[model samples]
Target: FFFVACETHRARAMQDRYVLVLVGVIIITFLTFHQEICKAPFMPHLTDPEPPPLPPMLMQSKRQLLPDMDAEAPPATDVPSPTDPAPQLPPDPPPTGALLPLGPSLLLYKPTTAPMWDPTFVPRWQHLVSIPIMRSRHSMRLLDLCITSILYMTPYPKFDVLIMLDPPSRALIRKSFLEGRLEALNAQYLMVPDPIYVDDFYTGKYWWVDWPMLTQYKKVLYIDNDVLINADLNDMFDAYDMEGGGHIYAAQEGEFWRMWKSTPMFGLTWYKKTDYDRMNAKGIQSFNAGILMFVPDQIFVTNILEMRKWMLKWMEREIPHFTDQSFVNHWFNTRLLSKSILHKIQLFPEHRSYPGKILLHWCASFGTPASVKYDKMSSYLTTFIEPRLPKRYASRDAMVAGLLRPQMVIAEVGCFTGNFSQVLLETQPKELHLIDWFKGQGSGSDADGGTVVKLPGDQALQMLQDRFASSPQVNIHRNNSLHALAALQDRSLDAVYLDGDRGYDWLMQDMLLASAKVKPGGWIMGHDFYTYDRVTNKKAEKSLNPDVEKTVNAFLQASGLKIYAVGLDKQTSFAIRLMHPVFWFK
Candidate 1:
């Protein structure tokens, strides 16, 4: 019985130990689960540090973090958050590949902004303004005085002035006019030191310095210091805007036309750099550096520099005409693109105007000192020093006469006075067609003492009536000679004289009219045929009018008109119809 009780106590003690170990294991497992739950929210901190406050996105785009969920999600149309790596877009199919090849590495990037330029883009027109440039030396008092007079006398309101001068001279100009009484005008003075390397007259270097100011303004009016701006330039400035960009605009240099054939190298010549060098190698004339409008751009600036260099070289080589203006004309004619900008500013007519003028130059071609003195004395002594007379004739008479002539008729092609017309009126015909492109009121009465019948109908007809009034027997029809000739029966007119000195075009028109109207043995005469003016001598290379030699020769050959007699003193040449040709049938 003692052995049995000892065995039972050992068994009970072993069973109690097993139960305590199981309870300790269960408590440890519960503590581990509670710690894991507390650390769940902190898992984000262990990852990237707040993921760099998502980059700024474009406004007006609805972005969503969770696209599928209804409550937390943005609208269905919302664009995906750019921060959330965008889905890889399909690769652009290679030109040679049949389909887009699968690739392990593919990245998609969205454009941030639209392209700067596009093929379909249209440009808007911009309003442009221009300033005239007047550059002068301090020593040229005549230029300064004239310019100052022009500024004061102009009827228009103040316009922008870009004055380029020596520093001291610039200051003096500003003090005298810009800052003083004439400050009301918008004027900017640019001071530039006289170039040490280039002589002023030879290289026209001063003009190059003024280019910077010209570029700043849309259009630049370049006037010589000797110019007299009698009229308001608002019309000229308004005309500039009509010239589109990348063009060189200029006033119709009437003087240039008169001398163009002689100096084929006169005026602005535009050229690409490569071509300019080629031209220089060939020793061709490029551009005219005198009064001109240049567009400030890379090509232009480069061309100007190249041109100046060439001119300097020419000066070094002892070219006869050392003037920069001459070089400029040479360059433009030789190198500039055919499509380059050329507009004729016809304020001044070369035939009448002096050396430099916007409107009318009193004495352009003064010969020897003695001749100049005589002209000056004559001008001063003349009773009619009136500016109004010339203006009236030029503006009203010239324009009116041009309008009245027939479409095919050639009216006064040259300057004709009343006395000259009366000489023709001595042999009166049934009907007289007097065409004067520029006809003024009669200064002297006709020899016949007949009252002048100044018609006020079509300008062309009025011109004829006014001209033939000396012969009361002749009925006058003032209209375009072309239109008048068209109405008349073939070979009906007794005489036709095309004396207008406009240009070759007018001369040709006159030939056409004379050929049609004149009967057998009818007389035809033209003025200014033999007269050689000195103004034409200086600018022979850039003359506007064709060489009278060539014009007369060509017309004589083409029209088959026989030369009757050359005038004794004047530049007049007369011709007569030998036989009326059957041109109408042809």
Candidate 2:
């Protein structure tokens, strides 16, 4: 029994050990799993992928809005390769200016302290620009002053012209520029330190320093009062080698460079050879200070003022040589700056005329204050200058011109004051029959065409008589257009231009008369097709002539007439008549 009891106790102890071993294994497994779960967040799985991109804040557009947009455009124009001038913005335009419409037609600007010329004066440059323009109200006959300035503006009408002034001068400028032409011209006036009295000249060219203001322009030109422009300065501006050291554009002073050295200064003292040679050398050219072209900048301005100061000191201590020109010759010729000349384009000899002469410098050309100086200047007005000026026109110029030919019989039905007859005259028609009543609803009507003078019916007849007096091609009948047109033989005229009496009845009557007179396939063109008032910037509620449009449409509808072209330009309608088979045969 004792042996059996000992064996049972040993078995129980072995069973307890087995239970302990199993419990220890379970605790170790739980601890290891918990540690692995904690570590899983810090180390991500390798198989995971990135999230998607966010939507746009707003809808995107594919439409092109830039010059460089990936679509084709006209190959870009090269920026003007003018003198290596720094880029420039045009001057701020002056405030609302006053127009003097009375005698001379002057426009006055609100003046500012802008400098007259550019800070950099490039000597003998070709491109043109300016400082300012002012009108003079003085003794020199206004016509002389006006024509002289007009010469400067003729070539550069595309740019602003600075006329230095007579109030009456604007009249000539206006006639030269504004009359029957459209040009992008702005007249600028420069105010200088005044009391410049040489032969009572008001332009005061001697006070050129006061011209350029603000120094903001890329290129500036000083066209002498005497110089005539042959072409625009764009070519000249481009001609310069802009890869430059600072320079000003001016003409070589020619004989004056050599002449002034020997001539007495102000007729007082002879310029010694050594003193003259200091500022003059064959290698170093003396440029005319009278006309200059330059870019405006701080350095250019500093040089100009410094040279002027020195010249003034020289002039005050001794008799001045060659007036203000002495300052320029000394400034550049001292090896102080760089300048160049294309020769044929710049200064020409006084006694010799070259075929390639683009600019004429008359500083001493007329020889010691000639009497007919202005008379010679005025002659250019009729010669090369006016012929080259551009003519601007309303739309449909070619269309209007193409309809007629030389020696074709035509009539102008509403030939009020023979305004449009001038254009038709260019075709040199065989016979131009003009029919008009020449009477209007008193004055202030389109009948007088807003001219200062109002013509009565009799006066209108007389005016046409005098205008066509030189040419036997014109025939005039001052009567009721209906009466006159009714009396005419059918199919007598090639065409009729109706610019007469407004209102439905008048327009229809004129059209009917034109229909009777004009041949089949002949055209009828009239003014005021669509109502437009420039000041209103909208279609007119009522046309200048009511039913001008309605009558035209009704005529076309009734007659079965095909309109070749229907156009509106300068507020005038151009329509061509097509032949109907019945009318042509009948």
lDDT of each: 0.39, 0.49
User: Would you give me the overall lDDT of model 2?
Assistant: 0.49
Query: TM-score for model 1?
Result: 0.32
Q: How many residue pairs clash per model?
A: 77, 36
Candidate with best TM-score? 2
TM-score, cand. 2 vs. native: 0.39
TM-score against truth, every candidate? 0.32, 0.39
Worst 10 residues of 2 by lDDT: 99-108
Q: Which portions of model 1 show Cα errors greater than 4 Å?
A: 1-140, 149-158, 171-184, 195-198, 201-213, 240-246, 251-289, 337-586
Compared with the true structure, what per-residue lDDT tens digits does model 2 show for residues 1-586? Answer: 3543454466477776665555556667878988867643221111124212212311223221112223332121211112223223223334532111111111112223332433443333223354322333221232233333343333223234454543334444454422111122233444342221121121234334455442545565665545544444444455555322346667665543556545432111333344346534645455666467666566766766555444333332333345555545545444336354644354432333335545554445322433344455456444654443222223333445755666678787767567667778888889888887767532222321244346676777777788888878888887777788778887777777776666787787777667767765466777666655446654567665556778887777776543444333435455645343112211
Candidate 2 regions exceeding 4 Å error are: 1-128, 131-158, 165-184, 196-214, 242-246, 255-260, 264-282, 338-356, 365-371, 387-586
